[model samples]
Target: MIALVDMNSYFASIEQLDRPEWRGRPLGVTNGRTGTCIITASYEARACGIRTGMRVREARALAPDFIQVPARPYRYAQVSSSIMAALESITPDIEIFSVDEAFLDLTACQKLYRCPVEVVARKIKHCVFEASGLLCSVGVSGDKTTAKWAAKQQKPNGLTIVEPWRVAERLAPVPVTELCGISTGIGRFLAQHGVYLCGDMKQIPISVLAGRFGNLGRRIWLMAQGLDPEPLHREVKAPKTIGHGKVMPPDTRDRQEVDRYLMHMCEKVATRLRRHQLQAGVFSIGLNTRRGWVARKLKTVHPTADSDPLIALARFFLENWWDGVGVHQVHVAALDPHPQACQGELFAPDHARRDRVLAVMDAVNQRYGEFALCRAPLVKRSDMPNVIAPSWKPAGYRNTLEP
Candidate 1:
C-alpha cells in the first residue's frame, strides 16, 4: 500500500515548536513586512478563518488574539530533514513531493513494522513528531492517486485509511479540478460544460474525455477511477540535461546583474551534471526576449562542469546573439550523459583533480553549509540575493533539491 503523509501547519508549527508559549493559540507566520499577507497560519488560527496566503491584516482582523511570526525558510527545511530522516529509518521507499509532503511505499516495510497501514501511520507520525516537534496527517490507499486525495480528505493531523473497496465512494465527492495538473484554463473549460466534479466527469464517455484532453484527459479519467500507473518513487538515472532559470521581479534587466545570474545558474547546473559522475559535451544558453526566446547550443571539445569553460561558452553566446539587449530572462542548459550510459573517458591530469575538487567541496559543504566556500564572484556580489544564487553544490539538505 502507498501512504501520503502531510505536515500540519508547517511554517506556523515551527514557531510553536521553538517557542512553547505559542501552543494552542492562533499564530501565523507573516511576511517580514507588516501589512503583507500571512504566508502561513496555525490550525487554531485556521479555525477562525485564517489561512496561508491571506493578508495579515485580514487575519488579525479575523482574530485579534493571533500572534504574528516571521517565516524562516531554512528552519522549515531543517525540520523537513529531521522528519525525512525518521521516515528513512522506517522505510526507504519515500517520494518527497515538497518540504512537508511525501508518498511512501510501505509494502516491503509492513512485514517488519508488523502492523496494518493505520498502526504504521500512527507510529510514523509519532516518530516524526518526536523528532521535529510537528504533527503530520496520513492517508493510506492501494494506489498513488487515491493515496494523495485520501491524505487531503481531512487534514491538520487528521488520519484517513482507504482500502480498495472504499476508494470509489470516498473520491466521488471531490471536484475534477482538484487533480494535481489541471490548470485554471482547463478547469474553466470543463466547468463550462456539466463537469463540476470527477464523478460528474466520469459519467461522460471516455472517448469524449480523450478527444478533449488529448493524452492528459485519458490519464485524468484513469486517475478518477484510481488507476494511475505512476510509481511511489522512481530511481534516479543519469542526467539528461542541466539548466537553471530565475523569476526576477517583473521588468528589470541590468546586464551586470544578468551576468551574475548567468554565472550562478551555470555554477549550479554544471555542479549537478558532475555530481552524478557525468559531464556535458554541449552547452545551451537561453534568453527570454521581448517577443520570443533565443537558444543557442554547440558541442564542446570535452565534457565539463568547470566554471571557466562554461563562463567562456556563455560569453561567446552573449556576444553573438545577445547585444546586451531586450532579454527578459536567462537560462543555461547542458546536454549529455543519460547517467546510466555515461562512462568517464580518461583525460588530462586536470580531469582527476577537477573530480577530486568537486568531491572535497561536496564533503565540506555537507559539514559546514551551502555557499560556505562559494565562488568568489558569488560571495563578492552584493547586488544578488545570497540565497537565490546557490553554487554547483549538491544539497543533501531535506532530501529535496533546493532552488
Candidate 2:
C-alpha cells in the first residue's frame, strides 16, 4: 500500500501552534513583504472566504479581524524535519513530497506491524502530531496518485482508504481536477469531452487521450481508473535550475530600487548554487512590467556561483532589456549547473581566495541567519524574500529553509 500524509493549513497551522492564543482564530500567513499576498489561510479564515493568493486588503474586507502572520521558513523547516523523522521510524521506503507532505510505501513493512494499513495510518497521524503538535490527513491506496487523491477527500485531520477493488466505485464521484496531475485546463478539456468525473473518464478511449495530451494522456487515463503506475520517488534529484523572484511593491520602478531587489535575488540564487556545490553555466533574468514579461538568457564562458558575477549579469539584462516602465516583479535564475569541482579557476590563487571568502560568508549566514552578513546594497534592506518554495524538503539540497 501507498500512503500520503498531508499537513493541513501548514504555514498558518504552524503559526497557531507557536502562538497558542491564535488557536481557532482566523489567521493568514503572508510572504513577509509589503503588498504580499496570502500564502496560506487557516481553516477559520477559509470559513470566512479568505484563501491563498488573496491580497491582505481582500482578506481584511472579508474579515476585518483576520489575523495576519508573517511566515517563518526556518521555524516551519524545523517542525518539518521533526515530523519527517517520525515518519522515517515507520518505514524507510518513503518519499519526502514537500515540506508538509510525504509518501510511504508499506508493501514490505505492513506485515512487520501485524496490522491493517488503516491502523498504520492512524499510527502515522499520532506520530506526526506528537512530533510537531499539528494535524495532517492521510490517504492510503495502491498507488501514489490514488493515495494523494484519497488524502484530500477530507481536510484538517482526515483518514481515507481505498482498497484496490474499491478504487473505481469510491472515486466515481471525485472530479477529474481533484487528481494530483490534473489542472483546471485539463479538467476543462476533459469536461468538454463529457468526462467530468473519475468514473466518466473511463468512457474515454486511451488512444484519444494520448492523441490529445500525448504521453501525459495515458497517465491521466490510468489515474482515472485508480491504476496509476507511477512509483514513489524515494531519491532526491538535483534541481534543474535554482532561482528566486519577488513581486515588487506597487509602483516600484526606480532604477536603484530595482537594482537592490535584483542584487538580492542574485545573491539568493548564488547562495543556493554554492549550497549544492554547483556553478551555473547559464544565467537568466526576467522582469514583469506594464507591457508583459521581458526576459534574457545568456551562456557564461565559465561556470560561476559567485554573487558578484550573477548581479553583474542581471544588471546587464536590466540595462538592455528593460523599458522605462513601472516594474511589477523581478526574477533571477541560475541554470545548466556543473559541479564546483569542474571549475578550473579554483586553481588560481585569487579565485581561491574569493571562494574562501564566499564560503565563510555562507557559513556565517547559515549559522546565524539569512543575510546576517550580506552585500553593502542589502545592508539596510528589510524586505528579503522569505517565501518557502513548495518543493522544500527536510534534507538534501532542497532544504533551503535551514537557517
Candidate 3:
C-alpha cells in the first residue's frame, strides 16, 4: 500500500497557525501587495469564490470581506519539516510529490500494523496537527496515483481508503484531468469526443486513445483502469537541467550591466550544483533582447560545477551571439550534469583555490543572508533584482527529504 500525505491550504494554513483569530475567515496570502494575485487562499476564502491566481483587488470585488496575509516561504518550510520528521517514525519510503505532498510506500508494513490503514492515516494526521499545528489529508491505496486522487477527493484533514478492488468505482466520477498523465488539454480533447469522466474514458479503445495523444494516450488508458507501471523513486531526483532566468525592465540598453547579471546567475547555478553533488558539461545562455528573445548555447570540457568555468563559458557565449540590442534578459543553465562529477584538482592552479574560496563564501552567505558579501565588480545596488512569487524565499529548503 502507499499513503499520500497532502497538507491542507498549505501557505494560508501557516498564517492561521500563527494567528489564531484568522481561523474560519475568508483569507488569502498574496504575491506582492494589495492589487496582485492571491498565491494561496484558505478554504474560507475559497468558499467566498477567491482562488489562486485571482488578482487581490478583483478577488475583493468578488468577495469583499477577504482577509489577507503575505506569503511566507520560511514559515511554510518550517511546518513541512516538522511534519516530515514526525512521519519518519512510521516509514522512510517517502517520495516527495510536491512541496506540500509526499507518497509513502507501505507495502512491507501491512502485516505489522494491526489497525486498518485508514486508522493509521488518521493517527498520522493527528500527530502532524499536534506537532506542527497544521492539518493535512492522507490517502491509503494500492498505488501512488490512486492514493493521490483519493486524498484530494476529501481535503483539510480528510482520509480515504482505496483498496485494489475499489479503484474503478471510486474513480468513476473523477474527471479525466484528475488522472495521472492526462493534462487539461488532453481532458478537453477527450470531452470533445464525448468522454468527460474517467468512467466514460475507460471504455475508449486503446488504439483510439493512442492515435489521439500518441504515447500519452496509452498511459491515460491504463490509468482509467486503475493501473500505472511507473515506480516511485525515493532518491533525490537529478535535476533534468539547472537554469536561472529573470525578466528585464522595459527599454534597457546597458551591456556591462547585463553581463553582470549573467555572471550572478552562473554563480547561483554552480552553487546549486555543488550542493547536489553533481556537475554539468553543457552551457546554455539565453538573452531576450528588445527585438525578440535570442538564445545561445555552448558546450565545454567535462561536467563541472565550478563558477569560474561556467563564467568563462558564458563570456564566450556573449562574445559570439550578442548582437547588442542592449540585451534585456540573461540566463545561465547547466545541462546533462552527472552524479559524482566532483573533479576538483588539489595541485591545480588558481581554479582550485577559487573553488575553495567560493565554498567559504557560500557558507558565509547562507549563515548571514544571501547578500552578506560580494566581489567588487557586481556590488552595485541595481544588481539585486527584487522578485516576488508563490515561493522562492529564504526558508523554502527546511523540509526533510522523506527518506
Candidate 4:
C-alpha cells in the first residue's frame, strides 16, 4: 500500500505553532510586502475566505482583522526535517514530493506494525504531531496517484483510505483537476470533450486519448480508473532547474532596482548550483510585467556555476525584453546541467582566474554570510527577499540539523 501525507497549511501552520498569539487566529504568511500574495493561510483565515496566492490587499478586503506574518523558510525547513525523520522511522521507502508532502510504501510499514492500515496511519500522524506539533492528512491506497488524491479529501487532520475495491466509488465524483498532472488547461481540454469527473474518464477510448496526449493520455486514463502502476520512487529526483523570484512592490519599474534584484537572485541560484556540485549549461531570466510575463533563455557553450556571467546574461536579456512594461517581478534560473568539462580559450586566461576568484568568494561567504563579497550593485541591498522555492532543501540551510 502507498501512504501519501500532506501537511496542513504548512507555512501558516508553522507560524501559528511557533507563536502562541497566532494560534487559532485568522493569520497568513507572506513574503513581507503588502502587494505580494499570501504564500499560505491558516485554517481560521481560510474560513474567512483567505487563500494562498491571494494578494494581501484582497485578503484584507475580505477580512479586515486578518493578521499577516512574514515567511521564515529556515524555520519551516527545520520543522519539515523533523517530520521527515519521524516518517523515516516508519519506513525507509519515503518519497518527499515537496516540503509539505511525502509518500511512503506502507506495505512494509504495515507488516512491521502488524496492525490495521488505519491504525498504522494514525500512528504516523501521532508521530508527526509529537515531533513538530503539526497536523497532516494521510491517504492510503494501492497506488500513488489514488493515495495522493485521497489525502486531499480531508483538511487540517484527516485520514482517508481508498481500498482497492472502493477506488472508483470514492474518486469518481471528484473533479478531473484533482488528479495528478491535470492542469487547469488540461482539465478544460478534458471537460470540453465530456470528461469532467474522475468516473467520466473511463468512457474515453485509450486510443483516442493517446492520439490527443500521447503517453500522458494513457496515464490520465489509468488515473481515472483509480489505478497508478507507477511505483513509489525510492530516490528523490534531482531538480531539472533551480530558480527564485520575488514579487516587486506595486507600480515600481525602475530598471536599476530590477537589476539589483536580478543580480541578487543570480547570486542565490549560483550558490545553490555550486552547493549541489552542479553546473548549468542554460540560463534564463524572467520578468513579470503589468501586461504579461516574458522569459529569455540562452544556452552557453561552456558549463559554469559562476554568478557574474549569469548576472551579466540576465541583464542582457532584461534590457532587450523590457518594452517599457511596468515590471512587477524578477526571476533567474539555472537549467539543464552540463555534463561536459569546462571549456577554456587560450587567449582568455582570465577565465580560470575568474573561476578561482568566484570559488574564493563563495568560501568567504560560506564562512561569513551570503552576499558578503557580493557585487557592487548588491552591496547596499538589504531588501533582497530571502524566499525559498518549492525545490528548496533543508540541507541548503546554513545550520541544518538534518541527519
Candidate 5:
C-alpha cells in the first residue's frame, strides 16, 4: 500500500502556528500588501471564499475581517523539514511529492509495524502532529494517484483507504480533473467527448483515448481504473527545467528597475541549477508587458551554472525585445540539461577556473544562507523574489523546502 500524506493549508497553518491569535481567523499569505493576490489561504479564509489567486481587496470584501501576512520562506522551510523527518520515521521508502505532500510505501512496513496499514497511517498522522504542530491527511491505496485523490477527499485532517476493488466505486462521482494528471485542458477535451466523471472515463475505449491524447491517453485510462504502475522512487526525479517569475509591485516602464529584476531572477535560476548539480544548455527570458507577452530563448554551446552569463543573456533579450511598454512581470527559465552532465574541464584554464569560483560561491551561500556571496546588484532586497514553490530543491539532496 502507498500512503500519500499531505499537510493541510501549509503556509496559512504555519502563520497560525507562529501567531496563536491568527488561528481560526480568515488569513492569507501574500507577497505584497493590501491589494495583492494571495499565494495561500487558510481553511478559515477558504470558508470565507478567499482563494489562492484572489486579490486581498476582493478577499476582504468577502470577509471584512480578513488578515493577510507576508510569506517567509525560511520559516516555512523549517516546518517542512520537521514534517519530512516525521514521515521518514514511518518508512524509508518515501518519495517527497512536494513541500506539502509525500508518498510512503507501506507494503512491507505494515508487517514490521505489526498492524494494518490504516492503524499505521493513524500513528504517522499523530507523529507528524506531535513533531510539527501540523495536521495531515493520509490516503492509502494501491497506487499513488488514487492515494492522492483519497487524501484530498477531506480537509484539515482526513484519512481514507481505497483498496483496489473499491477504487472505481469510491471515485465514481469525483470529477475527472480530481486525478493528478488531468489539467483544465485535458478535462475540457474529455468533456467534449462526453466523459465528465471519474467512472465515465473507464467507459471510453482505450484505442480512442490513445488516438486522441497519444501516450497521455493510456495514463488517463489507467487513472480512471485507479491504477499506476509507477513506484515511489526513493530518489526524486531530476527537474526538466528551473524557473522563477515575479509580478512587479507596480507595473512600470522603468528600464533600470526592470534590469534589476532580471538580475535577481538570474541569480535565483543559476543558484538552483548549481544546487541540483546541473547546468543549463539553454536559457529564456520573458515579460508580460502592456503590449502583450514577449519572450526570447538562446542555446549555449557550453552548459553553465554561473549567474553572470544568464543575467547577460536576460539583459540582451530585454534590450532587444522589449518595446518600452509597461511591464507587469519578469521571468527567467533555464532548460534541458543532459542527465549525465555536471561541472566540466577540471584543468581547462579560464573556463574551469570560472566554474570553480561559482562552486565556491554556491558553497558559501548554502552554508551561510542563500545569496550570502551574491553579486552587489543581486544583493538581498526586501522586494526581491523569494518564493519557493513545492517543486524547488537543491542538488545533492533528495527532499527539502529550503530555497
Candidate 6:
C-alpha cells in the first residue's frame, strides 16, 4: 500500500503552534512583514473567506480582525525535520514530496506493524503530532495517486483509507481536478470531453488521451483507475537549477536599491551551489517590469560557484537588457551544474584569496545563521520575503537557507 501525509495549512498551522495567542484566531501568514499576498490562512481565517493568494487588503476586508504573521522559514524547517525523522522510524521506503508532504510505501512494512493500515495511519498522525505538535491528514490506498487524493478528502486532522475494491466507487463522483496533476485547464478539457469525474474518464479511449496530452494522458487514465505505476522515489534527485527571485516593492525602482537586491540574490544562489559542492557553467538573470519580462543568459568560460562572478554577470545582464523600466521583480539562476572541480586561475592569487574568504564566510554563516556574515551592502536591507519554494525538502540540496 501507498500512503501520503499532508500537513494542513502548513505555514499558518506552524505559526499557530509556535504562538499560543494565535491559536483559535483568524490568522494569515504572509511571505514577509510587508508582503501584500497571503501565503496561507488558518482554518479560522479560511472560515471567514480568507485564503492563500488573497491580498492582505482583501483578507482584511473579509475579516477586520484578521491577524497577519510573517513566515519564519527556519522555524518551519526545524519542525519539518523533526516530523520527517519521526516518519523515517516507520519505514525507510519514503519519498519527501515537499517540505509539507511525503509518501510512504507501506506494503513492505505491513508485517512489521501487524496492524490494520488504518491503525498505521493513526500512528503516523500521532507520531507527527508528537514530533512537532502539528496535525496532518493521511490517505492510504493501493497506489500513490489514490492515496494522495484520499489524503485531501478530510481537513485539519483526518485519516482516510481506500481499500482496493472501493477505489472506483469512492473516486467515481470526485472531480478530475481533484487529482494531483490535473490542473483546471486539463479539468476543463476533460469536462468538454465528458470526462468530468474519475468514473466518467472510462468513456475516453487511452489513444485519444495520449493524442491530446501526450504521455500525461495515459497517466491520467491510470490515475482515474486508482492505479499508479509510479514508485516512491527513495533517492533524492539532483536539482537541475539553483535560483532565487524576489518581488520588488510596488512602484519602487531606485537603481542602487535594485542592485542591492540583485547582489543579495546572486549571493544566495552562489551559497546554495557551494553548499551542494556544485558549480554552474551557465548563468541567467531576469527582470519583470511594467513592460514585461526581460532576461538574458550567459555561458561562462568555466564552471563556478563563487558569488563575485555571479554578481558581476548579473549586473552585466541587467545593464545590457534592462531599459530602466519600472521593475517589479529580479531573478538570478545558476544552471547546468556539475560537481565542483574547477581548476583555479594559475596567475590570479587574488582569486585564490577570495575563495578562502568565501569559505570562511560560509562556515560562519552556517554555524550562526543565514546572512549572519553577509556582504556589506546587505547590512541595512530589510529581510527578504520568507516565501518557501514548492520544491523545498527537509534535507538535501533543496533544503534552503533558513531565515
Which candidate has the highest TM-score of all? 6
- Give the clashing pairs for model 3: none
The better candidate by TM-score, 2 or 4, is 2
Assess every candidate by TM-score.
0.77, 0.94, 0.83, 0.86, 0.86, 0.95
Candidate models: Cα lDDT each: 0.72, 0.86, 0.73, 0.79, 0.80, 0.85
Off by over 4 Å in 5: 32-35, 249-251, 276-281, 299-303, 336-364, 372-374, 379-385, 393-403
| Per-residue lDDT of 354 in model 5 | 77
Ranked candidates (lDDT, high to low): 2, 6, 5, 4, 3, 1
The clash numbers for all candidates, in the given order, read 1, 0, 0, 0, 2, 0
Give a tens-digit lDDT track for model 1, residues 1-403.
Answer: 8888888888788899899999999998864434266777888999999988888788879999988886666667677767877887768898777778888888888789787678888887887888887788888888888888777778878888888777777667778777666677877866777776767767767687689888887777777767766776435434466676654333446766667767877776766665655567788888887767778986667767666688778777777887655665778878764442345566633466776787788677768965577787777532322221222111331132423
**Better structure of 2 and 5 per TM-score:** 2
* Cα lDDT, model 6, residue 15: 88
Please report, as a residue range, the 10-residue window in candidate 2 with the lowest summed lDDT. Answer: 341-350
Leading candidate by lDDT: 2
Task: Give the Cα error of residue 183 in candidate 3, in Å.
Answer: 0.7
Between prediction 1 and prediction 2, which has the larger TM-score? 2
lDDT of 2 at 17: 90
lDDT agreement of model 6 with the native: 0.85
The digit string of per-residue lDDT tens for model 6 on 129-184 reads 99999999999999999999999888879899999888989899988888999999
| lDDT tens readout by residue for model 3, 1-403 | 8888888989888888789999888889874353266878999888888899888887788777887686665566666667766776677777666667777887876787788877778877887788788889988888777888888888878898899788878888888788766788888888888888878875668888889878877777767766754567666544587777765555566767777777778877777777667777887888888777777667766567787778888778778877677666777787776675345545545466766787898889779955476656657624333333322222222121110
Prediction 1 TM-score vs. true: 0.77
lDDT of 5 by residue, 44-84 (tens): 99998889999888999999999989888777767777777
Please provide the root mean square deviation of candidate 6 (C-alpha atoms, Å).
1.9
